[model samples]
Target: AVALGVKFLDAQRKELPQGGAALADLVTLDMSGLDPRLGTVKIEVACDVQNLLCGPEGASAVYGPQKGANLEDISIMDSALNNFGEVLSRVANTNLLELVGGGAAGGLGAGLVGFLGAELRPGTQMILDITGADEKIKQADLVITGEGRTDFQTAYGKVPVGVAALAQKYSVPVLCISGDVEGSPDFLADLGVATCFSVAEGPTTLEEAFLKADEQLERAAWRILTVWKLAEECQLKKLRHS
Candidate 1:
């Protein structure tokens, strides 16, 4: 089963089929006589593989702030994740607390691993695996990819880099476009990005940039392809002269 929400099981409150009134809420867990068909199903998730299931640096504490989780919410959620982890560990006959990438999507990563024998992997890799991206890359001469921003982090499993990696396998070049750019072209080129461009041509606020993103991207792509055609013609001319 593909679970999206991070909160696979809540411990603090009563939720349907997933939670209870307190921490360590599961007093009973029976896994015997389960369907054999489950083993045939492969489960995978897209998330960082470095996050712990619980603690200050765990999934909740680090990602909670962005989800409107205040200090109190974080404290409560962290405890809840701890309880949930304990229950999963007992049922699965293995400890999930230290499972790398277990904190992805809240604590769902750990739960899937414990419950379904799922494999937790980077988002990019999972997507490529699922979509048969390598086969598609083989059919293409070039790959263009983008994200909200291009920066140092882009080298680390970001979409552009992920796509670029696959394309690089067949020696296909990659170009990236983004809402904004925070790194130099040289840095990105070394990471296999042939060139990177921003949608915004001049100074613009975040609000304005978003409003014009579609138009800006369209124009940027046209400009890039036009330049590429010109360069191709120039190369052909040089070959003929030689």
Candidate 2:
């Protein structure tokens, strides 16, 4: 936005015209680039998410909490994004508001596609294809995937969920193990994740959590494997009886 002479006023609603980016009254944009558009340049932007530009699953509502933004902040910011999206669509002749992956990096995906005519592809899937992940997932009976954190945003195409989507095609189960879990991921079951687990044994301070992360993860993985083995043995016993 700086390059385009647009600026965001991230201030409280009560604070006024001095601090509102998404609120239409306090917003202004004039991004007619001095340079001509780069004609015939094929740009492929990789996104790890599939969030659209607006709505509940969009950027502000989904990611604002992680950045310390409260409900009020999210409401205001989302409104502002509406204004930005309007301008981008008009200027670029591209309808980016509801485009998939448009919410990546809080609408950076929309900006790139709107202004530069870029393509947004799932970053994880692109990497998987290049590394032949389909074959590996097809062969695995169960897939264990993880990330530093898992939350509602994970459904919008985080690594664990992305892997789960792939596993579903082959009827394989997926277990999501994370450092921590939050945000009511009830939909994960429908996405082929059998369950989600947290490595933390109990509550701890941030510093302590980071310090003991490796130790906790190792123990958690061991416990998970043990349970898996027990389940496998039980299945075998049932098979013998039948």
On lDDT, the leading prediction is: 2
Estimate the TM-score of every prediction: 0.63, 0.83
lDDT of 1 by residue, 1-242 (tens): 22432233334433326432244454434444456677799976777346788898787787788789889878888887788788778878888998887887777788789878888788988888889989988998778888887765566457887788788889999999888888585687776889899889898888998899999999999988898889989999999999
TM-score computed on alpha carbons, candidate 1: 0.63
Candidate 1, superposed: residue stretches over 4 Å from native: 1-42, 48-91, 94-100, 129-132, 185-190
lDDT of 2: 0.80
> Candidate 2 residues 36-134, lDDT tens each?
545467889889999887789878888788889999888988887777787678777888897899988988998788777889988888888988999
Report lDDT (CA) for all predictions: 0.76, 0.80
lDDT (0-100) at residue 72 of candidate 2?
89
User: Where does the lowest 10-residue lDDT sum fall in candidate 2?
Assistant: 7-16
For the record, the alpha-carbon RMSD of candidate 2 to the native fold, in angstroms, is 4.5
Candidate of highest TM-score: 2
Model 1 worst lDDT window (10 residues): 1-10
Clashing residue pairs in candidate 2 are 22-80
